[model samples]
Target: MFGKILIANRGEIVCRVIRTARKLGVRTVAVYSDADVRALHVEMADEAVHIGPSPVGESYLRGDRIIAAALATSAQAIHPGYGFLSENPDFVDQVTAAGLVFIGPSAASIRAMGLKDAAKRLMEKAGVPVVPGYHGEAQEIVLLASKAREVGYPVLIKARAGGGGKGMRRVDHPDDFSEALSGARREAKAAFGDDRVLVEKYVDKPRHIEVQVFGDNFGNAVHLYERDCSAQRRHQKVIEEVPAPGMTPALRKAMTEAAVKAAKAINYSGAGTIEFIADASGGLKPDRFWFMEMNTRLQVEHPVTEMVTGVDLVEWQLRVASGEKLPKTQGEIALAGHAFEARIYAEDAAKGFLPATGMLHHLQFPDAPPQGAAMRIETGVRAGDAISPFYDPMIAKLVVHAKDRTTALGALHDALARTEVAGSTVNMAFLAALAADADFAAGDVDTGLIGRHQDALVAVAAPSDEAIAAAALAATDAGAPGRAADPWSSLAGYAHFHTLARRTRLRFGEENILARVSARPDGRFQVALEAPHDAINSHDLRNLLRTARWPGHVTVFEGAVGYTFAVPDPLAKADEAAAATGSLRAPMPGLVKLVRAAAGDAVIKGQPLLILEAMKMEHTIAAPHDGVIAEIATEGAQVSDGTVLVRFEDGQG
Candidate 1:
């Protein structure tokens, strides 16, 4: 291994690479943008270099700046840790031309697998099974629509140049094909700078299974098994696991052998993943699976693979990049136990999973195992870090392992329940529900599973009386005089030699509730909430919930959901007047992609209004009711959460 190397990425992947580089006695250099000057990876690296501004195009994607930083630091190689420049073949060539080793596949291999259409063609030539689709170069809308027809209804239109669920659309009918094609083209162009796309047959009950394949300079490759990534929302993987449920020895043999074949065909090197889309209508079979695309670098769900194989994949990457042969042969790698990974993102499941941004006032993970540390928490932001809009809003990944699939699923559920976060909305409760879902427990997974069960999964329960009591206690300085155990803590209750009580107001969701609290003589407290729900007597609320309090907010975590409340200021003035009706607000911070209406245009309820692109996803703002347009936000404008995007006329005229 080299003495030093630079990680050409940011966030969790960069931090992940640093951990392994340290173990190999490799001094690592980290590159950061203005927004990440204080990122965790920068602090953990041996040396750090400032790249550029916050936006990716200005910072992380600047290959020249990254290469200069590496050369200046006297680094021997550059590790493109999976996002920005990892799959860019031109960047690989540039790095090689700069007299530095690119710690990944060669430019030739990346080009071979870069474009989905081209790669599918190559796979077909190599005798690998590929999905039936239109991988043609014709970009005309008329031609593409005909291809979609040929492929059948419910076809999947995917951008040939990129992955990660971006630039992808599913058309279920011919009438919607035109609109879907335009939208997919625009999104693809914005995301990948490529408007070209491919149409594929959408499999019924499709399951996403990808194999982890590694190769080295000596033309040797090995398979570390496969991961089931079918648990998805918006075409993104939410949960991943190894030794896919319901996998038979014969089927595993067929898939793994095919994966190895794909890797060798490309002369792949270092870490890579071969993703396949399988038709599970008749359960997993050798021929039911077809090639999806190849991820030419490390994946976000790689930890689950590491847990079962007892191999450090990063160490292997280093060894292979340093011109070493494959560490373990095909037979040496053996699956031991089951593992699960739940991606914890900073987003609201209730509001259609829109990305959220806020400070992480408090963050905590479950304790690792006492011996082998089976439970792993991979995170880049700490308690005080902020989840900004410039990057992916994933907070961390919760991984767990056990002797069996059932036990591992249970462990994952328990871990999610114990996880705590504050100052930002999250999807932990949704993840817990998914882990406990009957279908998931029985290994019945598919690409559309979330969409089918979203209503039940995203249904959030009202905060319990105990949770409200805890929030009330934390919102108000109930133990202001002293700790609850202190004798003088109850002095607020004894005014004029009589028991006294004070009322406090707290905001739960959209309504404010008045809660009455009184100190007990036994150094405890009693809370009574005045709301629509029945009231319950408080009893030792301190031991019932975990809370984190800020200046104007109190977050109470229970049942895997965080109930955050706004503690009104005593002296602050209230709003003078409520806003008028017929207003549509931006659900989250995003750029206004297009405004579908101008002032005075009449529209019916649920009509197309505006499209806001946030967190790399486009959300169409629709008219709430039949009304005439009054004012609308300008297109290409960046709006924040709750910013009024469009306003309707005073009355439906």
Candidate 2:
């Protein structure tokens, strides 16, 4: 193995590479941008280098700067961890020209499968099955529309040069094809600098299964089995598992063979993934799957494969790049157990999975996984780190393995329920629901599972009465349960000193809550909470929700949703009750892409008011009710979360 290597990436992936490098007694060099100055990855590296500004274009994507840093640090190789410059063939060539190894597939292999259209044609030539679509070079809009008509209705318009959901759209009718094509092209140009696209028939029921394969300089290749990534949203993988539930021996053999062929076709070196889109309308069959695309780098879901195969893929990458033969043949590798991986992101699944940015005031997980149990949390941020808008908003990857699929899934569900995050909105509740869903638990999943069951899965728990009482108690004394911070009792209220109940006022959003607490005879406190349109519900003193407090703030977690409440100051102005006003606020920090509605324009509920772009996704802010827009924000302004973008006319609140 080499003495040192530089990781040309950030976030959890950087930290992930370091762990394996340390295991092999190799030092790691980390590159960071302005936003990641205090990032966890920077602190974990043996040596660190500052790149550029926070935006990826200015920092992580600067291949020349990264190469120079590696050369200066005497790194023998550069590891581009799965994103940014990882798939860029030009970067690989640049690294090689600078006398350094790129710890991934060769430049020739990456160029062979860089674009969707070209890769599809190449796969066909290599005798690998590919989806029937228009993979030609005709870029005329009318020609593309005509081809979509030929393919059939409900065709998919995908950017030819990039992955992820950035430049992909699904059109069900001919009338929407033109507009969808335009939008896809715009995003494609913005993301990949290539607006060219291709059309494909949309599979009604599809299961995304991909094979993990590795190659070495000696012309030997092997497969490490397949992973099922059917759980997705907008073309992004959410949950992944190994030994796909309904997979037969014949199906696995066919898939793995085709994957190996695809890898060796380009003389691929190092790690790569061959993704296939399977027709699951009937069932998984030998001929029902076709190559979707090839990820020429280690994937985000690689941990599940490691858990079952008992192999460290990173170590393999280092060894292969250092002129070693294949570590194992196909016959030597075998599956041991079932494994699952769920991506935890700082986003609100209820709001179309819109990404959020904030400080992680309180972040805690269950105790580290036992040695053999293998419940792992792969993360790059600690309790005080912030999730900024400068990069991907993923928080962590939760991995678990067990004797079988059923047991592993059960452990995943329990682990999700135990995760606690207080500062930003997260998708833990949705993940828990998906893990516990009947169809998923039975291994009956498809790409449309999340879209079909989104309403039920994203219904995060609302703060219960007990949660409010717990918040009230946390905000006042700010002490652990069964202990009081001061000698003053709840009975010491009013001018008289005999005995009286204390009323504490708190605010959660527009709702005002009053908690009446009285000290019991046994040195205990009982709380009765009163809210709008409800009786004075008595809270069970014996049971209080888990809470975390910081000075004047309190957050009570209710099944992964943190409900933060603040105690109002008696001397402050009483603005909490001044409601009935109209204001449209930005849900997260973003740039205002477009202003669909103008001032004085009348709009109804759910009508598009403006469009905001954040974290590379577009979010449309709609009117809340029938009202006339009296004021509006600029179309090109960048604003933070909760910034008022529009205000309705008087009495329209």
Candidate 3:
């Protein structure tokens, strides 16, 4: 094995590579952007180098800078971990040209499968079952529409050059085809710099099952079973499992063989996944699946596959890249157990699952897996790290394994319920909801599972009456009566020995929790809370505040959501009334891409105003109501959250 290698990536994947490399006695050189100067990956590597600015285009994607860093650090090879330059064939070629090994598939192999349309044609020739679609090189929009018509309704227009759900649009009717194609082409150009697309017949109720395959330089390849990635949101997988639910032994054998065949066709080396879209209505069958795409690198959910296969794919990547054959043949590989992986992302599930960014003030997970369970965590960040906007918003991959699919799912559900994270919004509750979902538990899942049960997925437990009372009382700075901080309880009223009854209502979602609090003999307040149904649950505020321990703030973590109550010193509210209020705010911090309406333009509800790009996605803000635009502040400018872009007469709030 080589003495050192460079990890040409960032976030959790970079950290993942570094760990495996270190275990194999290979020192890792990490390349970071300006935003990641003190990131977890940088701190964990043997050596680190600054590539460029925070933006991926300026840093991680700069092949020349990455190559220079690798050479300067004397790295013998470079591992591009699944994104940025991972599938860039030109970058792979450049790395080999510089006398450094690219720890992935050969550049020729990548080029063969880089474009979706071309790859499908190649698969068909390789005897692998491919989706029935138009893979032809027709550029005319009318011709493409005709092909879609030929393929039947509900055709999928997908970018030929990129993945990660970008530049992909599903049109269910001919009337929506033109507008969707335009949007898909625009996004494809922006993301992959390629406007070329392919039209495919959209498979209804498809289950995403992908096989993990490995090969050596000697043309030997073996498959490591399959992973069911059917639990998805916005076309991106949120949950994945190995030894796919409802998979039959015959189906598994066929998919594995097909995956190995696809690998052999490309002379594929190292770790690659051949993803298949299967019709799961009748359960997995040998003849019911078709090739979707191939991920040319280690997948994010590889841990789940590792748990069931007893294989360390990263170690295999290193061995294959170093001219060694795969450790095992297809006959020797066997699935051991069932495994599940849930992607914990810093995102708001209710607001369309928009990515969130914040400091991780408090992050905690179960110290050990449940008895007889294999709970694994693969993360690049720790407490005190900031979730930056310049990268993917995933916090970690939580994997669980057990003797059976049912047991593994049960363990995953319990694990999610016990996991706690503060200071930032997360999809933990949503993930728990998904695990407990009836269809999901029954292995009846599809791409539309989350969309169909979206409301229940985002339903948070309402704070109980006692919890709300405790939060209100905790918000008051006075300590409990007879405690050190509440010694002046008898003199609270000043004129006489009296108690002040403070009433405060906290709003979460659409429910209002009412609290009536009074200071006791000690500084602590005796609080009583009432819910809408006259249900009362009393909470002792003493322990809740102490356990949360936020800096100058009290956050009551009860039920499903956290309630943030300020412990102000009575003067903080006076300072809030003096601020100006006419600013039209940006809902998120992002770069202003376009300004549709100028000043004084009449705008109606749902009228597009401007576009903002964040976390590799574009969002357009619209007018909340029918109003006349009074001022247009910024156009094509980078702005922070709540930065004003335009102002309207009655929509200022």
How accurate locally, in lDDT, is each candidate?
Answer: 0.88, 0.87, 0.81
Question: Where is the poorest 10-residue window by lDDT in model 2?
Answer: 533-542
For TM-score, candidate 1 versus 3, the one ahead is 1
In model 3, residue pairs whose N, Cα or C atoms come closer than 3 Å (at least 3 residues apart or on different chains), thus clashing, are 479-523, 479-524, 480-522, 480-523, 480-524, 481-521, 481-522, 481-523, 482-522, 486-523
- Give the winner by TM-score: 1 or 2: 1
What tens digits encode model 3's per-residue C-alpha lDDT throughout 1-653? Answer: 98999999998898888888989999999999998999999999999999999989999999999999999999999999988999999999999999999999998898898899999999999999998889888879999999999999899999998788888899999999997897788778878999999999898888889999888899998888888898998888999998777888899889989999999999999999998999877767799999988889888899998898888889999999998888888788778988999999988897778888888777777788966799988888888888887888898889999999889988897677566666667888788889889999998888889999999988876655555565665554333345445455522344355766666655544565566666555444566666353333223542433224355445565433455554444334566544245446766678887678988788778888887777656677888777788877576688876677777765354
Model 1 has an lDDT value of 0.88
Top-lDDT structure, candidate number: 1
- Candidate 1 residues lying further than 4 Å off, grouped into runs, are 369-373, 479-482, 531-537, 540-544, 575-580, 651-653
Candidate achieving higher lDDT, 1 or 2 = 1
Error of 1 at 621 (Å): 0.9
Candidate of highest TM-score:
1
Assess candidate 3 and give its lDDT.
0.81
Better of 2 and 3 by lDDT: 2
Model 2 per-residue lDDT tens digits across residues 6-44: 999998999999999999999999999999999999999
